[model samples]
Target: MYLLILGLLMALLKFLEFGFLAEVSWWWVLVPFGLAALWWVWADSSGYTKRKAAEKIEQKKRDRIEKHRESLGLHKRRH
Candidate 1:
């Protein structure tokens, strides 16, 4: 995600010929996107993406339970 964002920013800057970016080749401008693609491929093959998604869901569940607990004065709220 971060790499994709960086690639977009670089593309925008290159398209606008902003400063030094104007002199960079198209290949260089596209490197971040390529890296992002490669990262996605590796993550998917390794189950990294699924694990991260599961972790996020778990965190949301925990937050919701903590909020309910705090509302009911059942337990101390975590930071």
Candidate 2:
């Protein structure tokens, strides 16, 4: 699916005969720019990073619980 759109873009660029391709000599710029834009969107708006942060907080709570139990000498406390 993505490949089709890419092919069409390249074909259009060729058809238009945009001379920027030759003067800029940075034909690969489009790929990196697209990737950076994607990364920014996904990293900023997605829940993946939020979930990871939540997991870290849960882990810290567990660690604090273990420390509290050790301090109170209740390592073998039953639930």
Off by more than 4 A, model 2: 1-37, 77-79
**Top-lDDT structure, candidate number:** 1
Clashes of 2: 0
For model 1, which pairs clash?
A: none
Q: Which ten residues in a row have the lowest lDDT in candidate 2?
A: 20-29
Deviation (Å) of 67 in candidate 1: 3.2
lDDT of 2 by residue, 12-69 (tens): 6655766554344345525645765676678669877788899999999999999999
Q: Which ten residues in a row have the lowest lDDT in candidate 1?
A: 69-78
Off by over 4 Å in 1: 76-79
lDDT of 1 by residue, 16-71 (tens): 99989999999999999999999999999999999999999999999999889888
Against the unseen true structure, what C-alpha lDDT does each candidate score? Answer: 0.96, 0.68
